[model samples]
Target: MKRTRRRKFPPCGRVGKWASKHSRSGKHMKTKTGKKYWLFHALSILLILMLVALMCLNRGNPDFQNYSNFYWDKDDFLKRQHEMGFFWLTRLGRLLNLTYEQFYTAITGLGLFSLIAWFYRYSKYPALALAFYMVFPFLLDIVQLRNFLVMGIALWAFSLLMEAKEEPTYRYLSLSLLLLAGTIHNTAFIYIPFWLVLQWPSIWVILSSGLAFTVSLLIPRFLTEASLAQSSSHVLQRYAYLFRGQVSLPGRIFFISLSLALCLAVYFIQYSLDQDRLLEAGVKPKAFQSLSQLAKKLSYLSFGLMPLFFQSVDFFRIFRNFLPLYWLLFSIYFLVPLKAQHKRLEKLVLSLFLLGILCVTCYVLLIFSNTDNVIRTVFKENILLRLIELRGQ
Candidate 1:
């Protein structure tokens, strides 16, 4: 093979040289990106652990129902499994089962890990993302809500979906997981539509949302009948405390106006910002940034609307139902491009965020103190329920 010894390859002399150069450049880029991602993940995990720890420490004893009382629910579900129960436990237990004492510990550890994973997978600044998620008002208010377990599960599933490379298989799996999670709690239903919008935007989402709206319009009737049926037999006097709260229209109008104003302001500001940075960020800011920004601002402003919503409508009793939407929408801003024209503006924004956090902490403490009970209520009487008038009359 050396007989003709093609002239010794020289730099820039052959196509091979160009290919080699390109490969090296690509590898370098990959390495740099990988380093940044790992650093972000580590910081996210550290921040998440710290925040979770703070949440645990400051979890005040509020007068509310607790999840510990659900032993009967779990036991009943197990009993109904019959012959399938032991086999399911042996097999499924290997996957999800820990002893009773290990239950909460497992949930906490798994949740913390899932949270860290989600930050890394979702946000470029993972640490900041986790901090924001932790500080979210709804999350702060519903620390003891067992229904949120579904959300935790869905979050983990979403993380996996984000990382998955395949198309149809992963998308289907994610949907199935989302639906199963939704079944765990009515609030989980929000995730389903959101997932559809993110995944199958072509057909499924619009149809599903429209169908869902129609179905939602019918649910009250069905639920009312179910409540009446159960009232005769249930010792807790089913729906005994229904329709107990009211809010004035003037208050609703005020909140809606405030939310709309905030939305308009953010949209206008974001629309006037630089297009280059926005485009480079993989976000179509030049085209849809204004609308997205408005939606985000409105979502945050919607938190303030919950108090108003509860005051206005007796049927929309679960304000927490909208919370995930609030958090999810607000998180979109982190992906948007911001000029931060001056250090002062940046500092002002940072200060405002910090002030918001401080206010939330104080509010948490005030709510806890205002509660007329000793032990931390895990369920029916927790901050979220009372805030939504879901408490017994």
Candidate 2:
């Protein structure tokens, strides 16, 4: 028998490329993955730029005046923050000379970038993460600049804590970020609790969230009727504001029927997938466990608080924080394929899946378009055109 010459394979890295190019390999799959990642980053940068542009173009808002006055008419920055209680952002403004229109605009820009980065870091589907970031919170940031900025910092801090694993120094650094967020925005305290209990499973998350919902309903009445510490009443007053506003009956019905129940279902489906993957890997996935728990809690809480949204549409400002959890589940729902016994049934399911995405994309577009009540918005002509002109100048 003639001995054939044996070819020595190159390194493992090269082997993948060779196999991909020559055989039934993942050349197409890898390319698709790379494109998806590229799209994610591109969209993220675009949205951040849009946010900066909005801040720059819409400088006539009253808050912009306050920011500028803090710089020009300021006797002492510390005195102002003491009176206002936004110490962290005050320090940021003073340190960076961020009271300037351009400077604070830049700060908002950086905050948006960091916020998206935090979400994208752990997100299984970066596109979905970016989409949710754009749709709900991005607009709110334009108006509630300081509030969103503080929350954005906390969100970045949460990401740090999630990524830290058990490293003591990293955990401390994460806590420092959380502290910074709390100092700037008091609502940051709401999020700090989740970090302590990040390891809770879905069942516990559901139960705790339900308990929280019941507590939320009762606390407002208790705070109103009972005498309490000045600090306690002041804190509880935040929840007291929840029952003051009422959404239209039809709108409430629509949200409950079409949006809330579907969102909760998506979350449960994602949790099931998480369980299955954990079993398959058969190894500890400490990774993203904390985040998954957070998502589950937030989603369950959002469902629990659906009645509150009926009370006040503005509740969305608070509820929007939970929408990130919805987006995580939303992405997982689309990306993960369910096991099917029949291959043809899977194909039919694929068509239905694409149709569902189309329907959702249309609904979101329509919802944003029906901005009759919105005074300022993303669709205005000035964002890109003026952004380009300003950059050119």
Candidate 3:
């Protein structure tokens, strides 16, 4: 008798089965995404811990001695021709009755945590970006503690700037963070004009960066330390040293070639993105587009200033500031897109490219360790072993 009611129930049964399957698939995806997120977090934390251990345990580091001296002499520290953020940090450390070791370690840990956290949160391939950072700039940044701290702050501000397009209030917040970073290290001010023109066309960005580089070149020709030393402005006087030194011929060639190669790679990636409409289909189209444009502009600026690198190694600091953007660009456009293709050839190519990067990075680290007495401290001993020896001593 119930057979009459059971008739024509096929649509409802099919719909129920489809919904169940869809829900299971969604749940699996969510679980997979969550695991990946935690994995990245764990990796980031481990990296931060390793870096902090290396920097903090290396008491023989020349910069550590210099920073300690600065900490001991509060009045002299405040009076020095340095940014106030460092002075404030020293003051706070003293107020807390922290020893020089504790103070240094705390600041170093905090700065590194911030920097790695930013990379993990925003970067498409955070691990790759972190690896790139370690290869090129990690040692240098740790040596220059103040600059490292400023970089951490500047990157945080940059994250805010990235979100500013969606939420206007983020723009002001980004500006405030940048100002704070400037107080820590005046180079942060260089990012202000960049932030101002983030929405500009790629061509305009290229032109402006070229013009800026040209002006920078002219400034060295016109204004020497002698001229700047006589100026009333402390900022100008502080930068006078940049106009003094001459980089070696080998150094010039190496840096210029590296910059040129990187610039060409970025241009190639940009071309590919455009031709394939990858940006349109990318995870975050607008954000990635801005990243691509900014990366190109910064690459051009970095390359254009390579000649200046010959004038002074200090000019390379500008290149360092732009380095992270390059990592992000390459990771996003080059690697992420390739990953989506799931082709064995693409995967093999990616593996080889990464291997090449790692080899180059190792070569650089070895060179730095051998050439720079100060940097040699970093590689002299295993950090854990060093700490244990210190404890025993």
Candidate 4:
């Protein structure tokens, strides 16, 4: 009877073995994941093509303008433009006797390849991320902006820095990359605070101060005098208009209140998180608690909101540039407590969030499209005409 006995395998084990064998045979079918991967890639390619077409069709158009020419147009940008390290690159490339086509090809090729590499390395949905990058206004117009290549480098450096905390080598690489980026264009300076936030808090103030000092010294030399003259005039007028701008009393109050509430919420959340960490670490929580308390007190700073006289206010402009506020808002949404703990409820919440993001993105594209069209019309009607008029004058 024992010799005649046959061993039976469990159904689950049989399926597991079968599936494993099937996978090894290269006919492994993950219907869901495969479909998603293909779809993501297709969408990415489509988006990139659409963006390229859009840029190409409008390249000569005035709305898009010729921002790339800023570096080469000596009379227009002059000494001021040199402060941007890009001018140095352009000069070096020229000095090397490289043809214009050769230099351009090299820069654009590197920028694009780097971006593709970034997506491949970092994105869970690489295809979707690539699609986002293609259509983003910053990227779409980047090739036309001489500094955009450098900006891309800077952004990539920042992205690397985001993940480089544990790896000291990468941190140094990021610093070097950022320094190069700053040389190419100083806009990387805007992100220094965020970078500092990811670093040791003890050194944050000193590092920031040093960065500021470095920029103050290096930026002035390459300052595009031409652009600066224009930027200053525009900035000043914009400020004046913002501050003096007429706003409905209700609208003004609503936005100001909203801004204040948002800032306070962010400060409190951050403070709470810090306090929680300190408590968990079994450190003397009193000092940490006191600091958190101060942050909460300072959260009341929002109450000092002055009227947006005409919208040109420097304070308002500065406030408008505070992109970190959105990060806080996004964090709050994720932190929302759900009454129901059902799997279905969790799925529903995730789906709704994704849908909302899609809707918002569509709306933004529609707005940008409208603006692009308007810019095209204005450029067609008067860009050359304006130039002629200026010459006549």
Candidate 5:
């Protein structure tokens, strides 16, 4: 009988209003996210354009002169380098009747585009990844055109592998890309082992990394030994020649400490994930776990191989190779999750971490500025203005 008036209760009305509000907020959030995605790409394209202009117009640099020779003297190019991929690309450019500037622009643009595209698709913070790139390897890569191209291909392959780790098609494609990259630069072959190491169990990964570190510690001793220098293997001799330079004790310590700090940050992120801290912050546990695991593996690999930094400044490239992944980890784990949790201690840690990165960036800038002719070449008058002046002349 009382069914005559199932009253429209205030609570039910309030619940309906709350549900509507929540839905509207969710839609707003999605719209915001979509805008952010496009904005990121727009900025990325601008950055690529800026970098390409800077690199292509930097004609006075020693590296530029050396690379220019590759376009004119095929025989000398082939004789000086075993890698044939860039040579073939030059041939293609010649067939197209492209000038050296056009060819260099195409190659540099393609490489930078691939790297930035990968970051946009996979990284939680593409901007941060780009920032990391700028602070560490951008200066070096701008000059080392071939290596930069190889790095792009290698990273693209890595992105594919990560996307579909178990898919045979992706594996083959990634392998092919890597092989192509190796043809461009033999150092790309180094990633094959790194890729394999990523698939190991955590315990095995740790043990292998420890073993690598131990072996790396002995590298200094091996370098000093006469037998290594006298070895018949050309590869050993080449590496020995490359690794001949010694880093100062303080410099070595600083690099080792930086590596350790990265590894520790990864460990802390992983620990937080294990404790479900991120899950409590509304993160998808599975995705974050996968990322944390990947980050941990990469960090371990970096830590294991870090002693090479002590052997040669060139070894900095090795660490730089891994920086994109590190930035990805830091963005997703340390930046997003920690910030979302709104905990004071986590915020403090984030601030400290950022400060450390700023300091490291300054140090890198100091080193880069001190590099022979970098400031003169990089900070010179704008290339566009210089071209206008030349035309006016």
Candidate 6:
């Protein structure tokens, strides 16, 4: 009779433990990757498809109609709500004679690609990064063109900042790009605060946000009394808009509740993981502290949106500034096991995050399926069929 051998399986209690600890172990990485890695990627791919589906389904929107006003008359690219960069983009599309919808679709594709390029640098979990970008921000991107562009490039700048400590070139470049990012969308202004706090100490970010919030309240009074509100830039107008109670109550509640869940889930993961960073290779205490500080600041910035949600339902749009970091931390959280507190806090946070992630994914899927265009996009129309028809025309 041939000798039989037995293989050890990870225990039920320590499944999260073994996965976190041993996935890095040379002995276990290959054997364990199939179980943990595949599931994560599968979920990621599903979310990515939904992201694309949303953009594809929304071939034309109010923004496109706005763009059409400029394109039809072929007017001079004047300084409007859209900054120079955006007008130039529209100009190029109009010059090409591509329909506004086609041009928008193409550029949106490029934007998604640019996002992938920026996020690919700091993350190992590509699926999660793509999902994060393509999901929560999906609604805003559908209607807001400049914001989509600004968020993508600002994140590109943030990716540069993440490496600034080790690379002086990246440090200077990150700051310059951040300033440039501001011109594309006023929302990019948040990058300066994040960069400053990260370079100095992480604690100041909360103080900065508190100060800005106070300052924003003061501005609305000035803008209201003065004739400047009408002449102000779109972004400034947005600030003026956010300071007053302009948002719907039901809409604000839903927006704030969703944002709260995401922020809480991310914060818990970071808190749980901070305890174990010392164990990872090349992860210094000071470096991890810097990251922890960034996480805290981002979380606080995210929470600030809650009060703003009352004033502007679009307040959640600002979360785009901190989005890359959230996804980055999440990617790291999954990669790094909860070691210090070991199993208890680890599983608790991990389970919470998993629950939150799944809920968000399912929610997006359900919402997308309910759209009228989805049926048209899936069966009656598709990229390939559209391409053939365009050629025939």
In model 3, which regions exceed 4 Å deviation?
1-45, 74-82, 123-125, 230-234, 267-287, 329-372, 379-383, 388-393
What TM-score against the true fold does each predicted structure earn? 0.51, 0.65, 0.77, 0.51, 0.78, 0.68
Candidate 2's residue-wise lDDT over 166-271, tens digit each? 7657677767776776665555665666555443666776676677668656654554423433334454444455555567777567555544544445545445
TM-score-based ranking? 5, 3, 6, 2, 4, 1
Error of 1 at 133 (Å): 3.3
Measured with C-alpha atoms, the lDDT of residue 295 in candidate 5 is 66
Which residue ranges in model 1 land beyond 4 Å of their true spot? Answer: 1-46, 54-66, 72-101, 137-142, 154-170, 190-244, 247-393
Question: Worst ten-residue run, lDDT, model 4?
Answer: 317-326
What does candidate 4's lDDT look like per residue over 119-180, in tens digits?
Answer: 44433334444443343333324333444455456545655554564566767777787677
User: Per-residue lDDT tens digits of candidate 5, residues 238-269?
Assistant: 46655556888877777777767777777776
RMSD, each candidate, Å? 10.7, 7.2, 5.1, 12.0, 4.8, 9.0
Which lDDT value does model 5 have at 246? 80
Which run of 10 residues does model 5 get worst, by summed lDDT?
273-282
lDDT values for all models: 0.45, 0.56, 0.68, 0.45, 0.67, 0.60
lDDT of 6 at 371: 51
The C-alpha stretches of model 6 lying farther than 4 A from their native spots are: 1-29, 34-58, 71-82, 95-97, 132-134, 225-245, 248-267, 274-292, 302-309, 335-346, 357-393
Error of 2 at 210 (Å): 3.4
Judging by lDDT, tell me the better candidate of 2 and 5: 5
User: 3 or 5: which has the higher TM-score?
Assistant: 5
Q: Which stretches of candidate 5 lie over 4 Å from their true place?
A: 1-46, 74-81, 164-166, 217-240, 270-291, 333-345, 365-372, 385-393
Winner by TM-score between candidate 6 and candidate 4:
6
Instruction: Compute the lDDT of residue 273 as modeled in candidate 6.
Output: 60
How does residue 296 of candidate 3 score in lDDT?
Answer: 65
**What's the residue-level lDDT of 42 in candidate 6?**
80
